[model samples]
Target chain A: MMELDENKKFSKILVPIDGSESSFKAAQFAIAIAHKFKSQIICLHVIVSPQPHEYANLSGLVTPKQIDKIIFDVKKETNLWFDRIKEHQNSENNKIEILTDVILTGLTPYGEITQYAENKKINLIVIGTKGKTKLKKLLLGSTASGVITYAHCPVLVVK
Target chain B: MKEFKKILTPIDGSEHSLSAASYALELAIKFLSEIHIISILPSKIKYGDSSGYFGMVPPKYFDKYKKEAEMWFEQLKNTIKSNEFNLDKIITEVITSPLSVSSAILEYGESKNVDLIVMGTKGKTGLRRLLIGSTAQEIVTYAHCPVMVVR
Candidate 1:
């Protein structure tokens, strides 16, 4: 409807994805914005490493090898999500660059996401209202709220 | 591209809200969007209560706030005009409602089929250094369409 301007641009947009349909929707929205602005999109997924205490019950059964396997599986799954989004991008013939990052950390997902945005100097963040832990009763997910609270740049929350 | 056909931006004449307004204008210029700039005043009169509480609020209270909203709209318009952008499709309204500020904005946005809501991270009553204002938080939580919180 309008022409792009040099001053009003979202050069870099971050889309934090969890393995949820809502997050995929967010990614789609980000893709659309990227297509419009000719901006770069970074899809980040943070894997919250299970606390050591949680493994107390399965101390005998769970080993470091098992934890590695679990992390590997999670990484694989996260990659699939990236691929799915890439497929959508390709389907639309959108050539905007999409970069995917997976972070394994003990910190909360929101904390990590905000930190990454700050580190990357992200201009905008497009996130879902709810994440993998749907919590239908709560209108917004804790991670989404937390990110909104701490992010330094503008946040576009996709429903 | 997903075009934002209509964008709703609620302002309270605060510095943060002004910044959000400028951001919304930028986006609207880029998307050729019809901008709706609304100022919402929380009704001074309390509803669903006794007649005593209902009559406590002065009759001019709402009128006074409505006039204030008009001033804000004028100031915003001047600033936009100074920037030399086309304001042909821009709409400005003052909403006086018994509902909370965030609720009123959301209701109007939904009724208008607003494609995106761009608002400030804080309002006039927001505390400095606070993570986020309650009104912005509530809007982001409840709005059906995409909401952009400008800082």
Candidate 2:
């Protein structure tokens, strides 16, 4: 008979939310995993510049307020994402304690996300990919690909 | 490079571990490989003196270990016996102390030359895991073979 250890459980899971449908799906999957292991969820959102510095400089009238508005929109979307998570948890009768939402503002999305996971000692990262085609992904540099390459923790990229 | 032909899973009797085991079984079926399950006894047991009376030691500790092991083995055996899928082969091993869990697992994988290592994560964070980092993370970073960590 194969003997197994019985006391193991997942205590934490890091989830990155982008307010997209794919990210929401990833959150659903993360919630299910958390319920199964009675693990805590770290919901993170990285606020990134939609345009690069070179591009921003070219578009002269865009003020800091515009950037703040973008950040505010992302935060509002993240809160909506959490609201959906709460609804799912209540419906499923899950008892796992999820940590409060985390919002990180940075220029590099992948770097900030990876650094947060490492700093927080996150064991698993659940992320959603837009699932761009090979050429498109190469040209655009998808966040998921960057995370898979740089993240030290195990990453589950939900399509 | 050749695809993973044989895989070893170290089960810790937790639901998380069983989920990992189930995932391994599914992969084996897909890849036409074999699965080997292993359980390790902690190193503390080997260094401690056994001069005390048997009754003096906590019987529950022994019983818990035995019962958990039996349960996991039974699950694996039944899954194989049912023939629900083409698993190719299955094996199990239980090792008592004298080695740390991580080292034992690494040694077993190295000796067997398995293509992959699959295990469950404990998902610990912060100062709590400062000294003892996650086994899954360590294995993924250091293992010669690719590791698939199931949450």
Candidate 3:
């Protein structure tokens, strides 16, 4: 941790991206905060369940073509997101570090995000909420809410 | 109603609380207000009962704690002075009773009719804050005046 002067503002912010409109809004918010504090932004994206499974008991199948397609799609989308962030970099002189662009083949998004944040020692987490319907959110718990509950640092949930 | 001209900041010697103190000083400098720094002392220090010839600490231990708190306040004052911030007053209150920290701060802020309350966030999250929330959070929710949280 940097030795912070009591009057100094925030110096680092972590933003999670999922390529949604709300996520883009959150990115914008993070940019504003970073500009205010002269802080850097760390952009993160998680790739969950990259492979398909077809099994009733012990049978499973995944074609090479399908795996290649998933990997390519993940890389393409991630690059597009990075390009969007680069657009904002033209105005600020702060150092922006692309900490991690991960593709985790797992089912637990919340747990993975929490673990990554803990490992990184992020100052703050900025996420976007889909504002899902109450019933939908209850059944398929929103990732943003789950992250807020589990995050160790302050979370800003952009609507 | 008259605008608030005085503010009271309670310090616990924690970095979070010191952040609040810095924020309070900034606001005082902006609003041209006075600030009072207060520190409370817990009623008892529970040491083990006498088993051998050596015994637990005497009641005077509480006095020692009060003296230490005053010294901290003085050091804090000197630091602010070095920074060239003029503080109208610095107060150190040693409350030995079992009083709620949030309530004490709120009561003092109200009594002084402060326009704003500034505090620092302890930065607790997840299951750790399931039952016990941060004092800054409690103050923000219950304070009569606008509360600024400095993280």
Top candidate when judged by TM-score against the true structure: 1
* Candidate 3: tens digits of C-alpha lDDT, residues A1-159: 122354344456777777777677777767755654566777887767644444122446665666666778788877888778767655666645544465555656667777787887766676665422334333213686567556665555554
- For candidate 2, write residues B3-64 as lDDT tens digits: 44888888887665776786676556555677888876554554443433421324566566
Looking at candidate 2, what is the lDDT of residue A96?
70
DockQ of every model listed?
0.44, 0.05, 0.05
**Model 3 C-alpha lDDT versus the unseen true structure:** 0.60
Residue A156 shift from truth in candidate 1, angstroms: 1.2
Question: What does the lDDT read for residue B32 in candidate 3?
Answer: 57
Reference-based lDDT, residue A104, model 2? 41
Assess the local accuracy of residue A144 in candidate 1 as a C-alpha lDDT between 0 and 100. 90
How would you encode candidate 2's per-residue C-alpha lDDT over A15-84 as one tens digit per residue?
7776676677767767766765567898887766565554254566556777777767667766777888
Show the colliding residue pairs in model 1: none
Chain A TM-score values for every predicted structure, listed in order? 0.86, 0.73, 0.73
Higher-scoring candidate on lDDT, 1 or 3: 1
Candidate 2: residue B132 Cα off by (Å):
24
Off by over 4 Å in 1: A1-8, A53-71, B48-67, B78-85
Pairwise TM-score winner, candidates 2 and 3? 3
